[model samples]
Target: MYVTTSGRIHNFGAGPATLPLQVVEECQNALPNLNESGFGLMEISHRSETFQEIIDSAMGRLRRILTIPDEYTVLFLQGGASLQFYMSALNLLRPGDHVDFLVTGAWSQKAMKEANRIGDASPRWDDSENGFKSIPKNGEYSIRNDAMYVHYTSNNTLFGTQYHHLPDSDGKPRVLDASSDIAGVPIDVSAHDLIYAGAQKNLGPSGVTIVILSPWAMKRVGDDLPTMLDYSVHSSKGSLFNTPNTFGIFVLDRVLNWVEENGGLEGSVARNIAKSNLLYEELDRSSFWKPHAKKDSRSVMNVTWRLPNEKLEEKFLQEATIAGLGGLKGHRSVGGIRASLYNGCSIKSVEALVIFMRNFEQANH
Candidate 1:
């Protein structure tokens, strides 16, 4: 039952988010033999022409979908978004150069900790103080103009906070982790110096991180950096530095193509708005439940909520599993309920989950 989509199950896993039904069907055909090449997409050679086409198509569609300026180049590389945190820090920052990070939740906390260990860094506005419920609007922290980069996790998957309004840091290069929110909606990429997203949630799958960096940021990698850790080498080699994730790139291409056919970013954004709005509205209307993230900065991708108590949260998870909404439990660091509604999560899925929420509320209350 879990294997099939039509049995009224809705997957709410934050990473490894749901892929479109059409993509699954395409996978069925492409799995056996990709475009009659007699090799499945997973089995295709990464250096082969077929896989190159897949990579090119995916990168091109990513630019189109993200409205990435021609100034930035899209690179598909191995490693999740966490790898990107380290790489972004290492490539953009010199040993003693100052950097700014906005600590919002678990992902950024990891990013900050990792960046702190590597180079000079500072944080601007962080609201982990209020239990990660809100994004800092303005704060006393002074940003250095010559800062390497200002980093922020646009959407906090763990704590359900989002920066609906981005920070205004004059003349500073900015880096954003749009990992869980990529392609679910449109963004102003021009505002940031660089952007990185893991394909798992809204893009495609694990093992691939997509980056669009400014030409300036790309050149900052000095020869002293390790060859494997350098973006310049990866970009010069067309993300073919070492072996690329051929299968992940292939699926991402298909997913982005699906986004194009289904009305591109605007269509996905509208659908995502509807899906997340439904789930959040359910949480708002139910007396037995409450949203964890603040109202002004609620995430449209990951919605975290909780019952009155931990025991009730456990009970909700058990009942929700029985009801076929998989991976609805929150991250262990902030345990409760987290309904991840990414690009491919259908409105029908949200509707069924809302029904489950109503049932859970009734039973628990």
Candidate 2:
């Protein structure tokens, strides 16, 4: 159940999750000198033929896996998903235009705050009262027909909650900050108008953000926004309108290729479900531990749980760390423990974690 090869259990931290060992090794060998070019990827010119190949291949592979339509363009840019809030608002909504925001967790709240910073509308949602314990369970979902665009965090990384299914908000363009869950599975791109993610979580490393958007969104860049701040213009001009994070894009290409080689999106999706099942089933079978996330709202990638109280939670986290399952500390807002089992963490790692949890329960409870 342990990664005896490296003598460490699989890591479950939320963002910047573990990547394939093969991919890591490949990078280690190539990084000292990239592709016989006598320089590391970081040292290469993004506009040079070598780096352009890496970036283009990344875009192609990502398109193939996601089945992105021709009408959409993929841009690898900087500033993380946070900056998308500004770009999205600027591109689509005017100063007084309303944007319907979904407040699901800390991430979504942050999105709203950022949205407000860029525009005047406030987040209108029912998820705040219970601290996002559960996604609103209403049988009906109504869209504010006049909103510029509907923004939602598809997966709440901090609280281990997810929209089990995409909401049916008719006729409105939907924007999702999929920073934590990008490349975890296949998505129906047709359903969304725009989607953005920080590459560090599951793509490769920090310093870049992947944005996949439809051509329809281009028309929505209603104002002649700032040169750098406009997505529609950026996409029209290609991502190379300015200097890019060359190495980040290269590493992203390597990781996306790794995902494809190991059975593509369908394969990754299967692995994620298997990994989640292994951990969730064990938690379900135990009385000593309970899941903090609601059953229906549970996050497949970020699983969170709590001990009896603060004292127990403290002991559990420390003990869990000593047991070699690192990055289990919960976000301050949630204050329990979070295990972000991203694509990189192997199945063996999760199995080891399950074993450790069972042992901890037997001894303490």
Instruction: Give me the candidate number with maximum lDDT.
Output: 1
Candidate 2 has a TM-score of 0.95
lDDT of 1 by residue, 1-365 (tens): 34334654678888887898888778778987997889997888888888888888888898888888997878888778888888888888767778888888888888887787678777677676788897767544567777778888888888888877767665688789999887876689888878898999997878888988888777776777888888888888999988888878888988999999999999999998898888878878866887888798898988998789999998888887777778898988778899898988888888888987887778779
Give the per-residue Cα lDDT of candidate 2 at 330: 91
Q: On a 0 to 100 scale, what is the lDDT of residue 258 in model 2?
A: 89
In order, the Cα lDDT scores of the candidates are 0.83, 0.80
The number of clashing residue pairs in each candidate reads 0, 4
Candidate 2, superposed: residue stretches over 4 Å from native:
1-3, 7-9, 118-122, 137-139
TM-score of each: 0.95, 0.95
How displaced is residue 202 in candidate 2, in Å?
1.5
lDDT of 2 by residue, 77-177 (tens): 88888888777777777677778777788777777777775666556575777878776544444666687777888788888887767765567888988
